[model samples]
Target: MQVNLHDAKTNLSRYVEQALDGDEVVIARAGKPLVKLVPVDSTPRRRQLGFMRNQGIATADVKGDFIDDINAMFS
Candidate 1:
């Protein structure tokens, strides 16, 4: 839905709710489109317990060579 800047400002909360409900909101200035407000996909990420429990221990073998490791990735 297209709305003027003034109307968008006045009913900002309502427009936000509409966008969150999967409706597209277009804010216009002088009949020209300026921006669009759309809903972001907010699907919850799965919870994984202890995914990095031993990662730090594995890195202990490295002796202050973080910069070399990073540069090797680029090369």
Candidate 2:
């Protein structure tokens, strides 16, 4: 729903509640749409921090041995 800037400002709280309920809210200026209010999904990803410490990264898992090759080329 599109609303003028002044009206949007006056009913800001209601618009925000509408947005939270997954409704699209468009704020317009001089009849031109300028911004949209949408709900943001704030869900955290599952991760295990101890997994990294318990199973440390292996050196062989690395790609490209540029340091040794570069030194050999210079020598």
Q: lDDT by residue for model 2 over 3-73, one digit each (tens)?
A: 99999999999999999998999999999999999888798888877765757756772236577777777
Which of the numbered candidates is closest to the native, going by highest TM-score?
A: 2
User: Which regions of candidate 2 fall more than 4 Å away from where they truly are?
Assistant: 48-75
**What is the TM-score (0 to 1) of candidate 1?**
0.55
Please give the distance, in angstroms, between residue 71's alpha carbon in candidate 1 and its true position after superposition: 38
Q: Residues 16-62, candidate 1, lDDT per residue (tens digit)?
A: 99999889899999999999998777799999999988777554545
* lDDT assessment of candidate 2: 0.88
The lDDT for every candidate, in the order shown, is 0.90, 0.88
